[model samples]
Target: MKKDNANASLQARKEAATPRGVGVMAPFFVARAENSELWDVEGRRFIDFAGGIAVLNTGHRHPRVVEAVRAQLDAFTHTAYQIVPYESYVALAERLNQLVPGPHPKKTTFFSTGAEAVENAVKIARYATGRGGVIAFTGAFHGRTMMGMALTGKVVPYKTGFGPFPGEVFHVPFPMPLHGVRVEDSLKALQYLFKADIDPKRVAAIIIEPVQGEGGFYVAPPELMRELRKVCDEHGILLIADEIQTGFGRTGKWFAMEHHDVAPDLMTMAKSLAGGFPLSAVTGRADVMDAPAPGGLGGTYAGSPMAIAAAHAVLDVMKEEKLVERANRLGGELRERLLALKARVPQMAEVRGLGAMLAVEFCKPGSDTPDPDFTQKVRARAMDRGLMLLTCGVYGNVIRFLFPLTIPDAHFAEALSILEASFAE
Candidate 1:
């Protein structure tokens, strides 16, 4: 591949002009990506474990997704789902209503991003209950917007200096086994909050990541989901499951809530909703979603025709390829491998996750010292070896694995070998 010197020069010029608020403005630029592989402008190949931050569940440039977008583009690209009705939008919504967990009749709406989905879920909950407060969890990463940042639990980085956030958003503990916060203890914490702070009756919803994503790969205990249902039943608060990162077969199930045998009153989903295209959704019980007045839930590009078409193809790919089952198989293999590595390296503090969304945390052997330095070292070393990886958790001592469900077995093994070598170093 010939280097586009003109394009590269323009990119370099723009890099200096771009603001820092965009987050991931990586120094390198991708010339192309197919399946689970990415080639940079300079023609360096990388096995993409990041998957556009788990947005390419179907893999990069999947033929089905690409074909769908092309077909839709040939027809009409956008008119806005609200201003002009689109069959694909309605079809995707129907599919979501049917696929999202719960036996009850449900309704669905589309949004542009996960943050928008979350914001609308809260709005719908409050509208239905006629209440003001909502609850989230610590170490949770919702989004960057004010409302999202307010509901988010962390202080530094996300919530720092961006004070005076939206009120009525409370946070409770998410019981993490590695942290010794048990399910019962988390429930007690919620109880204490209800008694000391706003009454549960005034709370509109309790939103939780079925598996805490940015907070580390701590899977929420099944008992905790049951408890959340019980509390919601008692107070009539909606249970909003944020499945942004966990949905779309990243978890073994279509939705992570399936592991708990419970259903959210509302659910927010995005990331891999439309291959790599920007799309998100808010699906839930029909009545609650209907609570908000007409014209209450929508965006300029809420359900873009192109994204909806790609989403239809994505759903097709996930089902036809049986990616959910693949996620289960991949997660088991990953966990087994990580545990085996633990036996080899004592720094492997824990190996935990559901489906393909796995993580390996590191700490100083027997002590409680979170070895974030070690985690960063491993990440940098792995990146050097052409295997891209990411680190998360409050202490940044956890490395989350988000390989594409469609990654080839050969590439997967190669990435693992690189990871092992990095850990060894």
Candidate 2:
């Protein structure tokens, strides 16, 4: 493929071969990526702030992760964990059980994707509680699988024509103060849900994202989390933290749940677990996890040796390099820049997030109406200026910044400059 035509040619072929359901954010195709930089097939060097949709907290190809996967490749690759278990899988599980928040005894199981982890977590919760109903918040993005999609609150693209989804799943409002939804309002909604829809005794779990990922980077207020914990305890319903996007130090902590005083009964994690390798997990109370009998939860590729090796390295890199502290430092700097820019950019409505998982929302000048068009323009302008950005939120007016926690100071500065220019444009 010639350098000049590589991107366009591949795009054309992609259009012919792939379905529109799999959305493509950028027109250009990537050839290589390292840390926070990506080189497109056309040889364009761009600062990557999207971080592969928050899957590279350790960065594109950390040497440690690469070396670990390479070593695993030299050995035998696949032996279904159920058919023939591996020591690495058990070790990773042990590490997670110890690392995840909560002092209670915990156990873990692995899967291939975030959706699988979530789906299985629900299964475990239901089996443990002997209930059939689950409660999710509005604007939540659990996943796209049947149960996941059913649990998710957004509709347009994710749930449109995809349902009728699984039954007995309910949604209550999530507090978004910027949008006029208050914590009290959300709490009331949950109360009303129990009274008007599903009975508390029939509810198995209440799953929520620490920071809403696809619903926009809205941080779940600690008060609301604590309230939810109380509600779960009152009703004997399990609390499941959907940390697929907030784990692995994206939120400046090993797990986002650590930010709150209460701990989840079950937690789903993925995205940055293996530094881009496909792996996910559900870690929770030992008794709850063991509710599912043997042979109930294993997948053929649940704990691929290569992904397990890469995950071990990811954990090591995070600890050795202090990426958790780096995430806090980077997030502070980025939020400060965006807040400062808001003074000049009238459309900059709000800048909110936790740790390095930050976002900037846009609205029509002097009004609360969301400005998705302006958001799109900003993203396009940033791309033209060689900075990869991602737009999210229910209104599509929020620009999320998921740059690798490992992004260098110089490259981070350059990306910020490009972002400022994009806002100006």
Q: What pairs collide in candidate 2?
A: none
C-alpha local distance difference test of each model: 0.89, 0.94
What is the per-residue lDDT of model 2 for residues 87-179, given as tens digits with 9 covering 90 to 100?
Answer: 999999999999999989999999999999999999999999999999999989999999999988889789999878899999998888888
Report the number of the highest-lDDT candidate: 2
Q: Which one wins on TM-score?
A: 2
For candidate 2, the lDDT comes to: 0.94
The positional error of residue 69 in candidate 1, measured at the CA in angstroms, is 0.3
RMSD of each: 1.9, 0.8
Q: Write the per-residue lDDT of candidate 1 for residues 1-425, one digit (tens) a residue.
A: 34757446756676699865556624467879999999887777888888888899899999999999999999998898888898888888899999998989999999999999999998899899999999999889888889999988777678888879999888888887777888888899999999999999899999999998888888898889998999999999999999999999998888898888889999999999999899999999999989988899899999888999899999999999999999988788878878888877787888888889999889998865789998988888888888888888988899999989998888888988898898888
